[model samples]
Target: MISKLRFNTVVGKKVLMAVTGLAMVVFLIGHLIGNLQLLWSGAQFNGYAHFLTAQPVVILIELGLLAIFLLHIVDAVVLLQGNYAARPVPYHTKKWGRSKSKRSKKTWASTMMMWTGIAILLFVPFHVWHFKYHNPVASARPDSGQVSPVVVGVGSTGVNTSGAASAPSKEAYDLALQVTKEFKNPFVSGIYILAMILLGLHMYHAISSALTSVGANHPRYQTLIIWGGRIFTVVIAGGFLLIPALILSGLIDPAKTLATAQAANNQVAQVPMGVGK
Candidate 1:
């Protein structure tokens, strides 16, 4: 009987949502760590990007992530619909309801979960297209050596060991420079900051709720679990927010960084292919 209820019941759906949501939260932490590399040199960040793309399993990983993300979204929608059906009558007042016996766990974050999740859904594709598909280097300042020479066989795999300033070329698209340039735009920066805020709100409730759904309930550890989730929420959201904030404030200069990347690429271009090998 226990096995029969695993996937067919509302409890089963909540458990599935909890597991998938937690998986994504873990992915977010790893992604934040990788993005923090932007605080370093463009060459370093681009090298990291190059390494990721060069991996044979990258596509598989992406497909798997996509599957998990879609499943999470679908289940969330289903659960939300189920909730509406269960509560056909709307509440008269927007105030919180509580009794002497039990306190309500509802907060602003929990209340807005669906909306915030939808916003994040809209954000991910645009982000992927902006960084992954668009060639910002093509629109870069060519006169300032922001453009690097493209190698026919080799992509941006060339590491500029020279300490000179240069830009990433179409072949290797200086991703770090691209990031700085995009963030410098007021609209882009604003959108990213807003998105991170929504992510924080979503995560605040999600972590605690997910744990409860997964049967992690225990009076002894409840407070610790809730606080731990909040800390995780702040770190993930705050770390992402810092990037655009720094770029827009002129702390991470795009022009100088691009020139350095370009100079490195230019030097690498002049060297004979087999010389380094």
Candidate 2:
């Protein structure tokens, strides 16, 4: 049975699509958790970022995720094309089925899946460009060859110049601060919130659909599964929406939360060669 499965086959494509889509959902949950660290402190978020980037396997994981994303896109296009070819005549007046015996599982989210998916696809590149490649904070820092504080050691304490013990200063990339600055911009925050809404729509149907495709469609538990998907959609989407909303509302003040930068020369001079290790 496994040997007979191929990309040309419909079942094969659905299975691949289901697997890839589920993989992305897992990634989204993990990503949201990491991003939420921004609410705590810049030191905490930067520490989390440093831990991930410091791993040698991080590059490999990124490459794997890219492959999964591309595969999901290609499979979706093939399925869509096949669907159109199978039904050459578009429906003239589609209506939701209301009969109890034969109720339609269709939803607004399901109907607009392609549109939401496209919007998310466009947003992904812009997000990556804005946060990953562009760093206003780093760019503004002096050109001196000083190692930026990446991650602070957990529970570690260091003495200030006055020889008084203090919480180790986390003066690295300051991504948490940068995230605040970006979200405070009306244009950037607006785009982010809109993209999150579309993402919620896409996931609303996708979660149940992916589960069903993978054979989790037993009649006795189908309803339960669908409702669970709905709840998951709200939590993930709402969690993301709260970040920018809080920033814009002046609730998460970066000035009081982030670690202050020490003098440039002192920072560069104090950083050990084994930093971020």
Model 1 segments more than 4 A misplaced: 1-4, 98-102, 136-170, 254-277
lDDT of 2 by residue, 39-143 (tens): 887567756765665555756877898899899999989999998899888899865674443556788999999999999999988887787655422321122
Query: How well does candidate 1 score on lDDT at residue 25?
Result: 89
Residue pairs whose backbone atoms clash in candidate 2: 149-172
Write down the lDDT of every candidate, Cα atoms only. Answer: 0.72, 0.71
lDDT of 1 by residue, 1-277 (tens): 8666658689999999999999988888878887887777665666666566545576778788899999999998899899899988887865556433346777889989999999999999888777664533222222334332322212245443211343323244456765877899989999999999999999999998999999996899898888898998999999999999988998976436544436655444445333332
| C-alpha-based local distance difference test score of model 1 | 0.72
Q: At residue 152, what lDDT does model 2 achieve?
A: 27
TM-score of each: 0.80, 0.79
